[model samples]
Target chain A: MGKQGNYSFTGHIRPRQIRAGALRLRATFCLGGFSFLAFIVLTITGVLLLFYYQPGDRAFASLSEINSVLPYGGFLRSLHFWAGQLMVISVFLHMVRVVWSRAYRPLRELNWITGVVLFGLTVILDYSGYLLRGGQESGAAATVGQALFTSLPGGKALATVFFGQPSPLNGSTLNMFVWHVFILAGAVGFLQMFHFWRIRRGGGVRPL
Target chain B: MDLIESERPQVPVEVEQSGSQEKLPLIELQVREYIGTFLWLGLLFALTAGLKVPLDSSPKAAAISISKAPWVFGAIQWLLQRWPAWLSGWVLPLLSMSVLLTLPWWGRKVGKTWAWIIFLILSLVWVGLTFVYWSESIN
Candidate 1:
């Protein structure tokens, strides 16, 4: 999208590029590409969903209104939900594929570890998404999650940072909303960029 | 030493032939990737369009027993069923992730072997837990 002379992001795909190739495009199920696509869909749908969603005590009621009253809101919500689910599945399969191919050897070891952390973050991303819906199930999840968080070291304080201190039911839901839409999403996006840059630096997903 | 005799004349290659390397433009590659991404998005949109987002009934006073963790946590939840939350939820998850992060240092052979072992055990545990949870739920 920049000046052809500069060739910033597009530089990775050039023929003289000693690092990567079309073979990477040809091989395997293209899980990494599919995962990125899923993430894009999730982001777009999530942003759209944000416009209609209200946090806190009215969250559940607001969601119900989005489902019933807003035009295409239900479809948008479903797309966001399914895209998040797809990202989780694709990212996992992608990891398994990399390990199976023995592509994480030697210089690629750090990328592998980064991948593991990315996987954990993806799981948290989905978990926090559920928390955003603010239904009975989500409320129950928060309760159990809070219990789990409180059980760890300095857990009380850490839990406050992560999920906020318990307040009225709505109060906690608002906190969860902030974490889900902003905090966790931002972290995952940043880490994924690192993950890809590392992949390129480490020689682009192994030959064939 | 006969250094003059050993030094053979170097042959010059044709510049045109040397320049004829088969490298595609980066834009071509971007187009291909974009096509695949759009196709995936189209299929995903169609799938999502047909399905409605589910909203469970509102919270009630007696919602605890029915409350289950998300499906991804089903396996970990089962561990919690059999052990303390600190052990199953916190300690085990942390241990497994840390082990995974440090796995590649074991060298390719040992690392691969251990990775498979860990993966298999986790998969088996998850399957077993899902089965148990299913049976318990149905009954």
Candidate 2:
């Protein structure tokens, strides 16, 4: 068997050959592909932003500097922002498409569950990113999130673990920065790889 | 001959179909992927260049009433305004998530058409709430 026919890593990523029907634009409408594209854009732009972005008390100032001072800083920041927003939207649309095609039935059920989890994590990542802006609006948003957490039993401790100490004026905290940049984003990246692997293992995209 | 053929390993139906169907080289898919990436990147750059994402007022400034959450959380925030935190923040959202997570099981139980309907209604409710929240925030 040639490389395409083998179950090698490259083959898993893109098989040596695909059913002609699956190649049609409508087979998947490429929504999942769009989501992954947005993620790649976000990761690149996010790393660029990280060079100058500061968390905690300096967070807003660092962002302001990025917006106005650094060369092309604002453009990179805007790209990151828009990509995050687009990822959320595309993931939701992908879920809708999955349902419309009844792609979640039987053999594909596990993939659907993984997708649902990814969607939820994407929303939380967006929220956490908002908090990292270190503005009063972020402060208010953080307050609401903290309130939600605290409403649960032993919620106060959970709130501190996730939110750190955010005042009403600034929501940015070292805790949130780590979560947004490392933990949550890392989980999404790992899960996305698994999701793609599962899709390939399921005999690639089903012909429409 | 029949006995010997029966002893041969059977390819799964999906794999068999994949092999039997008219095949296209992986390059075909790669080309499409490339086109998509370029078009998507073009749109992102166009958006970035055309519209500046606004920075919030400095945190040092007097705190102003923020009646909005990020648009992604707009629906939950809208509900939070009308209902108790536990209900709006926890129960309803969790219930919706539960419904979504179990959709495959629902398909098996209620049929695919009904499952689609259930999902559509759920999605409409959340999207509708987010729009309502957006309008109110702007007003």
Q: Which candidate should be chosen as best, given DockQ against the real structure? A: 2
Of candidate 2 chain A, the 10-residue stretch with the lowest lDDT total is: A3-12
Once fitted onto the true fold, the runs of candidate 2 whose alpha carbons sit more than 4 angstroms away are A1-7, A206-208, B1-20
Q: For residues A1-208, what per-residue lDDT tens digits would candidate 2 score against the true structure?
A: 5654445545566667766766778768888999988988888889999899999999999999999999999889999999998899999999999999888986778889999999999999999999999999999999999999999999999999999999877889999999999999999999998888777666654321
How far off is residue A104 in model 1, in Å?
Answer: 1.3
Stretches of candidate 1 off by over 4 Å are: A1-10, A13-26, A165-172, A205-208, B1-24, B60-64, B108-111, B127-139
Report the lDDT tens digits of candidate 1 across residue range B1-139.
Answer: 1114333222126522554223444555466677777777887887787766678556534444554667777767778878999898888789878766776764454756787777657656665786787666557
Candidate 2 lDDT at B31 equals 85
Candidate 1 residue-pair clash tally = 0
Clashing pairs in 2: none
Cα displacement (angstroms), candidate 1, residue B45, comes to: 2.6
Candidate with maximal lDDT = 2
